[model samples]
Target chain A: MEQRKATIRTACVEALPLAIAIAAYGLSYGVLATQVDFNALTAVLMSVLVFSGSAQLVAVAMLAGGAGLTSVLLTVVLLNLRNLLYGAALADGLGPAKKWTSLLAFGITDEPFVLASSRFQKVGPDPLYFAVVAGIFYIAWIFSSLTGALIGDHLDPQKFGLDLAFPVTFAALLVPGLKGKPVIGTALAAVLMALCLEWFKPGNELTIIITGLLAPLVGLFMHRRSDHG
Target chain B: MVNQWILIGVLAVATYVSRVLGLTVMAGRELNPAVRLYFNYVPTAIIVALIVKQIFIPSGGHLVLSLPVLAACLAGALAILLFKKFLPSVVAGVVVGLLVRYFL
Candidate 1:
């Protein structure tokens, strides 16, 4: 029991920083949802149900851009392909939870994936830790969206630099993980692939998915070559 | 709009299925080592792509660098490397980005 407490406490402390960054995006999502004519209830409800930062934000942004439902769904599907990878990798860590795995799977997005994977790596499986981290992020996302919706169109997101939070938050999460040659090679490859995709057809929706699928091969090759050498 | 709600519902279900499928299907199985390594590397690849996507915006069919976004991302990356903290790094990045946006 004492060990469980320590695990939960550690999870919370680790999850807190990313949760703040998630909240910043949540607030922006709420405000954007409203701009796209989503009622405050719907805005908050979307956060309640979906709990995904990228999908929710992109859904609203595409709607605001006058994208149709089919297009939005297709794009969201592309964005969500990574979740399968996250879920698969997280499956073992969450296996002991049994029925609870379904409940925990909701937290299988990027930040939780990072936090949970690290914890699992360090201490082995601990569903309690995953639960704590997911719970904190869930509360942060839901409430922040509500706050942003209630604040409504009166405030400007850009003026306060809410827009910058997305990339900056990602950068903060990403930089810590850039360890070793293979990983650095993978990131650099991803950058090049993304830039090339964007250059070819600017704002291409497939850039992330394609880059994600392809870039790591470069890292794999580099890893193999270094091993042989 | 009713359309928005329907879209939300579709998205919620689709997203949940994607999230749950992997956990359930792969839970007990031991994956191939190479596959496991690839999965481990996937997040970094996706994140780098995401950051890059934001920093470069296409305008009139040409790629242009958004200096503020690029600067902010660099500042945030540097801050995190220095402090090993999340919130402060984000704040530093956003503040620098905002200054660039307003002053430039």
Candidate 2:
């Protein structure tokens, strides 16, 4: 019990800044969802359960566009494909955790995952730590969404093009990580897929799925070829 | 309203399913070296794709030769060069973007 208390305390201290940044993003998302007419309950639920800002933003955009259910689902799934890699990489760290650890892992979004993964390596596996960080993020997201919903549609940011937050954030994230051909190639593949979808029959979400699946394959093939040479 | 709920449900399930699938495939095992190497670059690729689509091509229909967006990008680039912090650069970009929109 003392060990658990120590773990939780350590996790909270580390998770503080991440919780703030993530909460800010969630608050912005809540504001946007409310402006788009999503009820407070729906908005809060999505943030708490979906817990993926990129996927949720894409889903909301498609919803505003009157996109079909199939399109929305596909877009979200494609956007979240990276979580697959995140989950896999994190699996080893979770090896010593209890069976109930999966519940905490469910809340492992980008920020917490990075922070938790880094700390988990140094401290050894601790489910309580993961739980503490995930819980903080989950609560922040839900409350922010709830707050946004209650504020109603009075503060619409779309007119100012604030709807571009996702893309902007993604852009900022992208500029730093392009170190090699593998990264460059996958980005090119995604761009090509999006362009083709936009210009041609408009595959909507399938474009994301296709690109998400293919980009990694391209990276794998390039790595193999480079190895052979 | 109901549609929003539906979208929420679909997105939640889709996100969860992908996570579950990933966890299962890598369950109780170390990641393949090849796979691990590629995973290192996925975040960069995803973010780049997102930014290109968002900042460069705001309107879905066409890529406008956007001076304001370009200016904002430059400002953001400078912020990054100076501070080396992601949020500061982004905030700089957004503030510059808003200014550009308001003035020009």
Largest lDDT belongs to which candidate? Answer: 1
User: TM-score per candidate, in order?
Assistant: 0.74, 0.77
DockQ for model 2 equals 0.37
Residue A214 of model 1 has an lDDT of 80
A1-229 per-residue lDDT for model 2 (tens digits): 9888888888899888877777666666776676567877878888877998767755664554445788667656656666777777667666677676566668656776787788768977766777788888888777866775676456556455455444444455555665577777777776776566544543243444455556666777777887888
- Assess each model's interface with DockQ, reporting 2 decimals per model: 0.53, 0.37
DockQ of 1: 0.53
Query: Candidate 1 has which clashing residue pairs, if any?
Result: none
Whole-model lDDT for model 2 versus the true structure? Answer: 0.65
In Å, residue B53's CA in model 2 sits off its true spot by 4.4
Q: Report the poorest 10 consecutive residues by lDDT, candidate 2 chain A.
A: A201-210
True contacts kept of 2: 0.37
Q: For each model, chain A TM-score?
A: 0.72, 0.80
| Model 2 residue pairs with clashes | none
lDDT of 1 by residue, A1-229 (tens): 8988888889888989888988877876776677777778999999988999878876775565355777667657766766877888788888899898889998889888888899899988888898999999999999999987887556576677766766776787789889988889999999999999999989877776687778778778778888889
Residue B49's lDDT within candidate 1 is 77
Instruction: State each model's CA lDDT, in order.
Output: 0.81, 0.65
Q: lDDT tens string, model 1, B1-104?
A: 33977998999988898899778775567767666656667667777877887898778999889999999999999999999766688889989999999899
